[model samples]
Target: MTQKSSVRQMIGFITDVTRWSLSGGIGYQLFLCLLVVFMMLGVFAYLVQWKLGLAVTHMSDIVSWGFYIANFTFLVGVAAAAVMLILPSYIFKDKDFHHVVIIGEVVAIGALVMSMTFVFVDLGRPLQGWHIIPIIGLFNWPSSLLTWDILVLNVYLVLNLSIPAYILYCHYNQVEPDPRKYRPFVFISIFWAFGIHLITAFLYEGLPARPFWNNPLMGPRFLASAFAAGPALITVLLVIIHNTTVFKIPKQTFNKLRLIIVISAIINLIMLFSEVFKEFYFPTHHSLSAEYLYFGLDGHNSLVPWIWTAISINIIGTLLLAFNPGKNKPMLLLPACILLFVGIWIEKGIGLIVPGLVPSPLGEVVSYAPSWVEISIALGILALGMFVVTMLLKPALIIEHRFKAEKPS
Candidate 1:
């Protein structure tokens, strides 16, 4: 593969992706239309925010980060969770998992793009984003965790994109992808995935001023919840893909993923219990944020319902998976997976991010709720992620189906 031939092949790949994505069934076309509407509305809302400023949002000096950052935090975990599939498929050489590993890469690409979009939208002055660029801006290098986050995330995104592109290109051309060519990058991605999420965790835990996020367990808890929620989402997606397309996912694949979700969810709940007990048992000044989160502080209990709802759902979801692990039980498995996905969304997003900044470190308590503008922009970003996944999956699925049909029995 010379450079010119590689570039030409890449262009051909893009053309195929566009053609397949656009030529889907009625349901797919309708879904794409719906996403476009939401994306347009988000753009209009963002333009309003850009014109008026951060005043359009509910964030104040007391709670500088709001809904956007919360979603950004959760999506980073979702993005990093792709390692669950990559590790088993590539490192362990699980044949069933190899069939769906490309799907996980597609999911990661959508999620990483969404997470970055959330960060960009949260910026009050979007133009100042250039300040984080390596040469064009200061970037602050090793001194700033934010700089580290930016570096790892972009690198991970490139790895996910390139690895899949090379493999799928070979499949498209009916050639075997040389392990020597792409295997090293695959190995790098496995480790890079962990680094991305841990760096994100350090972004919070390193802040001593925010005692709520400063726990040493924060990194482990992040990984635990991510593995659980990320796999849960992927499970539901694989089910949907199996039903709607020619791609056939094996029963054992779901079984293996279910086990991972159950173990990770249990660990996440145990960690949650440990943190809760540590806070309420001996009640110190450091527990003030957790107190405010669960029990309310000085008559402020905005997050009490949110936290309890998340806890109850997660507990119920975990039990459902643990007790009912049958291979073909989509009725039980689907609901449990959906529950875990939604519960962890709440747990990792609002439940985690808001309280860390609520008390303002000076004992001043403030409340935060997303404005309509924020809601619209967040929905738009989510819609964009779905669009990306749908587009990428169309071509990838076609390639997978073709290769599977060609394989010798």
Candidate 2:
């Protein structure tokens, strides 16, 4: 294709995506409306915060990071989890996985967007975010993990969006995608996926003052939980897609994804156990954060109940997956996946972020709870992500269906 023709084709592709997003059934439209309402509320709340300042939220010098950073941490893992699907489909050449890989890419794009948004909102002055940009801002490079994180995340987002767009454009044109053109990007994304999450983990582990996040296993634990939670989410989404739309997913695909989820969940649980044992058995000054999380520190035990509940739910979910009691039944499988996803969200979000800063380095204890403003903004960001995913998926599904129909039998 000539350069001019390629540009024209890309414009047509975007036009189709917009049309499909806006033209859906009553249920889909209602869902979109609900998301829009929340988005509006979030925008209102953000504006209030912007005018009033971070003081409107509960974060203080004692607990510098709060609700926003927690979500950012979890979403980064979710974004990285796309590699689970991509690696298997491309490197291993799993044909069944190839059909669904684009779906994973769409999810990654939504997640990365959310992750970046959270980072933006966490800033007291959102406008200062320009400083993080490479040329326009003073992005401290090489030495700064935040700069590294910003680099990897933006690159991964572009890769995910472009690769899927290339394939879908080819399908729209009723032509085969050139592997030579896109395959290199695919391989780069697999490694870049790991880099984004690992760098995010480094952001925590690099902090020596916060012993709770300083473990060497932090990166591996992040990866394990991400692989488990990410696929669990995708599994639930696949079921919804199969039921609601004309597209059909293969049974083997579910089986393969389930296997990946189970293995990763087990590893995540084992790592959790190891970390707990190390913290409780030795009982050093460094273990204070863990103690604050699980028990109470100086009678301030806000996180105790949440952590235990997350652990219990995670155990139940993992067992449910291991036993296979439902025998591939959606009734059983869906709940298990939901449980795993929610449990990990809690474990990684509040369970991880809050404790690291609970008992301040100076031995002061400060409790943190998100204000209504923070909650509203987070809901808005999450709704926006769902909205994006829903819109993107419509055009992707249409293209996939058409491609399958036109393929030579």
TM-score of each candidate structure, all chains considered together: 0.97, 0.98
Whose TM-score is greatest here? 2
- In candidate 2, what are the lDDT values of residues 349-395, reduced to their tens digit? 98899989978888899788899999999999999999889989988
Where model 1 places Cα greater than 4 Å from the true spot, the runs are 1-11, 325-327
lDDT of 2 at 325: 92
Model 1 score (lDDT):
0.91
Computed on alpha carbons, the lDDT of every model, listed in order, comes to 0.91, 0.92
Show the colliding residue pairs in model 1: none
lDDT score, residue 216, model 1? 96
Candidate 1: TM-score? Answer: 0.97
Error of 1 at 139 (Å): 1.3
lDDT of 1 by residue, 57-97 (tens): 99999889989999998999999899999999999999989
